[model samples]
Target: MDDSSPPEPTGDGHYERLSLPGSEFSPLDALVALVRERGLFVLVAGGVVLLGTAYALAAPSRYTATSTVVREAQSEPEGIPSTLPSIPGLNIDPGNAGRTGLAPSAYPNLLTSREVRLAVARDTFYFPETGRRTTFVKHVNQSPGAVELLIDYTVRLPWTLMEGLGRLFRDADRRLGASGARSPLLAPSEEEQRALDALEKKVSASTQGTGALGGESGLMVVSTTAADPTLAARLNASFIEHLRRRVREIRTQNTMEHLKFVRQRLAEAGRELERAEDSLAQFLERNRSVIAGGGAPTLSFRRDRLQRQVRFKEQLYGQLQKKLTQTRLRLQRQQPVITVAEQPTPPPEPSAPNRSLIIVLSVLLGGAAGAAAVYFRSVLASAEAQESGREKLEEIRGSLTAEEIVQGVREELGRT
Candidate 1:
């Protein structure tokens, strides 16, 4: 046998041979032994199952509710402009309209804005059963006499030692150039920054998804979430209503203003036209005999001038009539140009607290923890066995050496 190689088993079962260096035990045998030795693995797995069951039972049940609002495009009028002259090779369709001012994607952010939040916050209750009220902050000032007493009791003072050190440092700073040095601090104005601080706590809004819903013509859905579902729904409805009102009001105001200017211009044109007709009539009356004497030049000139004046007045009047009709349509509240395809409904459930997902995660986590415990326990048991075997090997080596020493001394005595 080679000394470098490990000793092979003699089949008499004195010792077992290792396939590799330093491996005296089979993994399969170790596992079997571990299974026989440790009842803790079963206990740990049972504990894990128990904990998982407890978590599933103890956790709060979560419910989700969603409400959708479909944004619709503004309706267009049915007919082409009467003034647009028909010509060859010209293809004009009234249905080919420009995009509406409002967009579905834009509404989501507006639902969560401070403007919407403040509006909802001002209202006390959407429905009486919810029993929720809006809360506002109020600041009160202390009376002059109580101010000093309140300050003395409430204000924290510096330690005496620290105060003394601070005084020394302050005196040194005052004596040096530090006293007159400029500070680098810059701050926004109170009024300008006041709204910014309240923005986050005030409003919450989000968009749901992309594309139109249900293959509906010109319909886009937007959804908003809030602490209060009723308020969220109300705010969303209000935002859409507000947007429509604003668009209409703005358009109406602009159109009315333009119409007023146009009407004034028309009035001025009418007056000018009347005066031109009167002057032409007088000229014709004065030149009636001259034109009747076959002077075609004078007759043609007067007719042409009068025709031009009539045409101009007619065109101005026509434009004003068209503008007036449009303005009237815009001002009418009954006919909303941008109609709400779907009204906002109070959500039936909160759109959060996904319970099923949480329970699944808990089970997975418990299994992983149980597996880690089993591995750690096995490793610790193997380390302990290795330490115990090393100590026994040291003791055996010491005893064998002592016996050899005794035999060597006995042999020397016999030789003597």
Candidate 2:
């Protein structure tokens, strides 16, 4: 074979190899590769491990309370259930939503709605970091839970740097806001808005369906997170109460509206009937002789007309009264669709800030750093060795004969 060509493997698994490139680096090889930077690598990797440990220690624990609910059909509701249009992301399956109509799917979203959340805030008390308990609607901010605390730790320095830069841009607009120039864009007042935002984040409503929104069954979950376990449980319970009340409102709103309109019509019909009867009575009193005279032309025509109007009004009144009764029955027969499947209980343990996993990941991170360092050094060494070998080959070629080069190759192959 030519000197530049690769040799084929011999039958005994030996070959006259001409070149070797360091294609693979095993774990042990990685360790031995970066001998010169071992101290630096140790320091950096150890620092990463220490940082992770500190983060695990510093992160606060948070409790989660959960309430379960199920979607159910009303007992033989007449007409269509009011499909109060759901918020965009609330019901995942828009196409399948109309199968039973909007009412069933809307129950889940009713829990997370702005109205329900606002009402919950008004009911609850807010305890700030350094103050006494005040009405949540006045000024409310609950510190973020464990997950947020962990994220804070992870991105603390970088976030601080970014925050400073952001301030440079937003400082003027903030001053304008502080001065009472109401920003046209924001709907809620600052205090109310903050409370809503906090409550929104703390509350989570999830359903058991594989639909676009996921969680489809009658099964649903309502959860709340707070620093105090009891508070979390209480919030969840309160939210559920609001949800039930809202469900009742939605269920009866249509019927009640129809009932109100029917009652108005019934009253109007009664008044018209009374007026018609009174007019007929007065006309008879003025012309009592005409009916007794039985063929007074003017009296007969006037009396017949008045009698017919009175009869029509009476019939209309009866119809409206019947409609009123039916509407009331429709409202009364419909019971609460959403029932409490499971009540919220105080969670005994914090669900977040997985200390064990955090530590394990920290160690793995350190190991990864060490591996990277080793690979970096190995590449540099390989480049330097290649350059040195190239220089040596040039020197050898200039000084040695072809026979020497061939003999040296044979010897090297034999030794291998």
Q: What is the clash count for each candidate, in the order shown? A: 0, 7
Badly placed stretches (over 4 Å) of model 1 are 1-73, 76-123, 126-132, 135-289, 296-299, 337-350, 369-416
Candidate 2: tens digits of C-alpha lDDT, residues 86-128: 3221222322321334455676677888878877877755443
CA displacement after TM-score superposition, residue 209 of candidate 1 (Å): 12
- Per-residue lDDT, model 1, residue 106, is 57
Give the lowest summed-lDDT range of ten residues in model 2.
Answer: 89-98
Q: What is the lDDT of every predicted structure here? A: 0.50, 0.69
Against the true structure, whose TM-score is highest?
2
Model 1 C-alpha lDDT per residue in residues 189-240, reported as the tens digit of each score? 2222232233334334444454544332334444544456665576556556
Task: For model 1, state the Cα shift of residue 233 in Å.
Answer: 5.2
